[model samples]
Target: MKTFIAVLTIFLLSLQCDRFQFGSNQTKDDQAGAVVTFLQGNIFITTQGKESKAKIGDVIRPGDRIITKLGRVDLQTYRGEVIRIKDNSDVLFRDIAGASRQNTDIHLWTGNLLVKSVKLKSGQNLSVTSPTMVAGVRGTVFSFELEKGSVPKVKVYEGAVSVAFKTSPKLIELNEGLSKENYTRLVKTLEENEVVLEPGEKLEVNPNLNELVYLINAKVATGALTGDELSGFVDFENGLSKVNAIVSPQEKAEVETLVSIPGETIQKQIDSQNADNTDVTTQTIEKEHSEKRIEALNRIASEAEKTGLDNEEEIHSHYSVLETIHKANGEVLSGAVVAQLGDIFIVHSTKGVFQLSVDDIEYVEYRNFKVKTRAKR
Candidate 1:
């Protein structure tokens, strides 16, 4: 009878061990602070060295990294703040809290993000950090962009923000427009060296002069300037031209001479030289002029490509392809594009033919899959 009792006790302990193990696994799965409200087209959630395809209602825990490729995702935290991540973006959720939060830090590696925070409880704050700058806010709506080879750009639509450089400790407070009087007061508060951006204002931060010039040139090439902004860009370009001419006097003289000759004249001279038994000196000059003219044409072509028009053919090739649509209200649909009629898109999806307005869609991404049919005997 004592032997029987010993065996029974051992079995009871084994059951308890199994139960504990199950509970531990359950806790790990339940560790989440936010939910993915909307996502479409190749969104992924990576955590603890494991990655999984993201879907609506997927829980986003702290330390989770969200990546979107040719896609966009909208997430809602438990605290009710909304984060909209644009295509080709990677963001890390450093901290997430729902109850009496202290702080939340979001790290943006690249791409753009739109944040809308209605209000933060007392003692709570949120901040976004990029490679070059950090922006802190209590409760606000703002957008941040981290484009390659450019400094971070921040635009505020509502509420105030404090921005600081990543390489330095200095900070500046930017306030949205409360009233004309209040806006004037906030502007007066800025130090001579500090920058405070008002509502509808945008700022780009760069400490390196060369990088600033490149960033401005990129914006101009992309047609992102207007009105006074366009005028300022023109003036800046003229200044750069002057500086280049001063630094390379000989090159400037050569360029001026080349510019005076008509294209037809240059081509005619080349043709004439090719047709004649020209002397070596004249042949050498002809060759040099031909090379310089080709170089100038190539440069113009390169600049035109930078405007993104050269990729028009590639962009249209995927219009009729099958894709997945992620909607703002947490619905996923699979479809092929039928046609686009004005501001609305006609899609033939699993749910049947539907007309979707661009404003209702979060993102649409082409699905990548292959199917094999039986080979003919």
Candidate 2:
């Protein structure tokens, strides 16, 4: 079977490049790339359609729907957060939902997604619904996805949701297994064996777990950073620190460096570069300063990728062909695609999303979602 071969490989080159440390809640490794975690399910990937039972390292992509044999697909973020996609459903992953920021956001166009967001000062969030409606989070576990049927429906199995009413001053709380009438119209909040949620606690749901949704161990965890996944990894890392106090010294140092003016040498250089030139007024100076700050931030992230696994190995399997298959042997790109089961891979040279038949793309990566952010402190 000329299946999607997920050949994993890693080759770190030594250089006198400027290095930085991992920020709080961020991973120090880049191996994880954009993809945090994935598993084999009844997946379909293609321009329009495809079917296969993906193995260990198959890359998954947007427009791809994964149907688990019995349950659903559980995708964990670096912050130990989870998005459980139920069986027999479809959720269109819109974007990477940036990983390295204070909050990681994943937009699910349609399908069932059980989200266990890792808390941070600016915690992570996963939105799994149409544009009209969205799920907000402030560090907690929850689930939302469209249930299959003649008419697609939205379901939230855990946590409370500030369900926006179609037309009224009424915003109700949709708890676990509490059928939210806003979207699904399957409105039903199981009152039996149910405990009232504390303040800041959203709806409680047990779509698959049955009546008792509170005991499902919805506590989300954090993971290390790896590969180009530094950005998202950083987000998770920071989130962890804020929620609790789980941070490495290296990360602490880096965070400190970001908040301050940084090294004197670079400071002097930047100062001189913009000094005295009245033409470089406050506006210009601030602009240049901001750019440098962002550069410093990228440096911090890049250096962090150099760190170890706490940074898992999910996003380190993509490759950049050397233009020609015969010639481009082992010549990968700066970024890689970590393969999932139904990843519609469009190699740099290929025109469309080609079927990556690599059984085990040992080294694969999915790009992290980009966000508008300040470079550094």
Candidate 3:
């Protein structure tokens, strides 16, 4: 009887050891990415049927769903890519770290997200999947914005990106000077749908029509279009051939006046005057013109913001100069303000979306008004 009891105890001990080993392996397999940083409002993470509030220095495992409400979260993957998820956005970590053989895959459900990748080693990859399109990238800086009813928009900043539609087998390049004809051809061609995007190019993918539309409207907002192009594209009488019910004649005039004064030219004139000790009368006149130009720009920005606010459901339809960050070293960066996390301001410039440290910023110029940083309490 004693011998039989001892043998049964040994068997039970062996089973316990096996269970311990299995639990250790399960924990290792469930490991995911981590939250490197975050700022303002509520950021929640739901994983494995459990929901919890996320904070800085928290570990985010694979299969985790991150939801941001009135805040932003910056997450870093094992491969050293930083993803900044903006306010009112939902993203799922479909694959991260050891979850998949591939590098990383993120799914953006709604709102905007900016991705900045470190130089990748050979065979490393990062892909962002949206409702309509999938962007495969390597060592690139880019942004993805999505709305419920409209299509998804992707903009590249530094590196090139290849975007493909979920339904179509083709991919399209969004390189510089992609002509309207080539764009149309790609839309029509099924096999040659893939496009590479260069810096400063933005494209929107329409899943419903299986079409890609280059946002030429961006050129209008940035004052890059010539008078003829503007008149042709936006003028009610001869351009779009359709009347713009939203833009009043006075507003059109204001836009024209603001674009007429080149910001670069004004800066150059001011520099030259200061260097040559120009007459006070000439300097004063130039300064007055610059001030007036700034005022006009502010008015336009305000009107655009107000319009967007009034039509919140159609906010994506209105493109406006969101804000300008002036660096202490005299560099001016402009674009839509994606988010402000602590002392860092993320701005989507023509080059790409950049994170500007508040410590390095002299001030922010929005709608022609100068705003200095507030002192920390």
Candidate 4:
């Protein structure tokens, strides 16, 4: 009984510092153009006084739904954000930040949400967190899952996110917008439209893929790929050696691939098999560059900064990576090689990167993953 009371007390107290406030007068009639569409599950649209409770496993899609948990609730204001609330999940909404940028705040008790948003602007983001995780978005679309665990997982579907509270600053990560499967479909559709893929191929959008794979696949599909581009992919094996010494041989191979992993995944394999690495230097550099894997990481971060939490963990966690390569001291790597560095991107042009460390770095520039500690608190 004591524990139950404590839990309830915490939820009640959350309203104190909560920032998302919905106005009662901004009802459906006030916002005549705002339309709510239930693409999948039954979603209830209510006003401030109308909504009070919601259960877990409940799905809300493409529509206006009055929430009732008491602090904040998020909406896909651009009408592009897709969100889902699981059973026993209670949420509350007060007001949207502004119409120009589409910043919305949401608070969830216990469940899940899948969100897809149109590109938003600065200060037009979302702030949400459970006991395990916290996410801040700028103007991207994605999904979030909260359950009882050591840490909750945040997944991005369309845009990018910066997620904190998982570990260190690197845990202040970048996530992607589309799933690998979706990316593949995107590629197929592009190919089909360009008369390149098999006839009748459709754009495939999967919710289960990590955003990185999705972006890569999408680039491969929509972005023009010439013989030289295909050759770059073929250069994988040789380029594979450059990052070897800094990362585990197995890890080096697994980390850079464009393979697709499904949604509902906990990234256990990626987590458990993180090379049992104790090389702090490699870990630091790796974590930093993870977001700088390429320019796209920056683009995602640039867009996410619009949300107040751009510096937070939830959004960018889904959209980043680092690419390091080594060549003979004098050999110049191709632009393609340099482009691989996404966030805190780096290239060890020094002799044998295998024998390098942060100390060896001539200089460093931290990008999407800032060196400062916004997470420790």
Task: Give the alpha-carbon lDDT of every model.
Answer: 0.51, 0.32, 0.53, 0.32
* Candidate 4 structure, TM-score to reference: 0.29
Sort order, lDDT high to low = 3, 1, 4, 2
Write down the RMSD of all candidates, one decimal each.
Answer: 31.5, 24.2, 24.7, 26.2
Q: Runs in model 2 with CA error above 4 Å?
A: 1-41, 45-53, 59-71, 97-111, 148-160, 165-377
Which tens-of-lDDT digit does each residue in 145-175 have in candidate 3? 8876667777766687777544311112112
Error of 1 at 105 (Å): 0.9
The residue-by-residue lDDT of candidate 4 on 301-325, one tens digit each, is 3333333332223222322332233
Name the best candidate (by TM-score). Answer: 3
TM-score of each: 0.44, 0.31, 0.47, 0.29
lDDT of 1 by residue, 1-377 (tens): 33333443444344334311111221222222555554557899998879999865465767889999978776656565667787899998777654434456688889998786648775566778775455777577667788776677777666766564332111111111123343233223211112344445566443342242343334544555333332222111111100111212222222222211223332333344345532443444345544644454444333323434212132233232457878878898775544432244555455554557788789988866445579999
Error of 4 at 304 (Å): 32
What TM-score does prediction 1 earn? 0.44
Put down candidate 2 lDDT per residue, 1-377, tens digits, no spaces. Answer: 01111100000010001110111233332212122133334644332476665432233333344555543444433334445565655555443232343334344444555555545453334434432233445444444444332121232223443332111111121122222231222111211212322222333333222211111111111222122221111111010000112333232322222221222322233233334322323244334434644554445444434443121122221231122222124633333221222222222222222224343233544444343578886
Model 2 scores worst on lDDT over the 10 consecutive residues at: 7-16
* Poorest lDDT segment (10 consecutive residues) of candidate 1: 236-245
The candidate maximizing lDDT is 3
Instruction: Report the Cα lDDT for residue 248, model 1.
Output: 26
lDDT of 1 at 214: 42
Instruction: Find the 10 residues in a row with the least total lDDT in model 4.
Output: 235-244
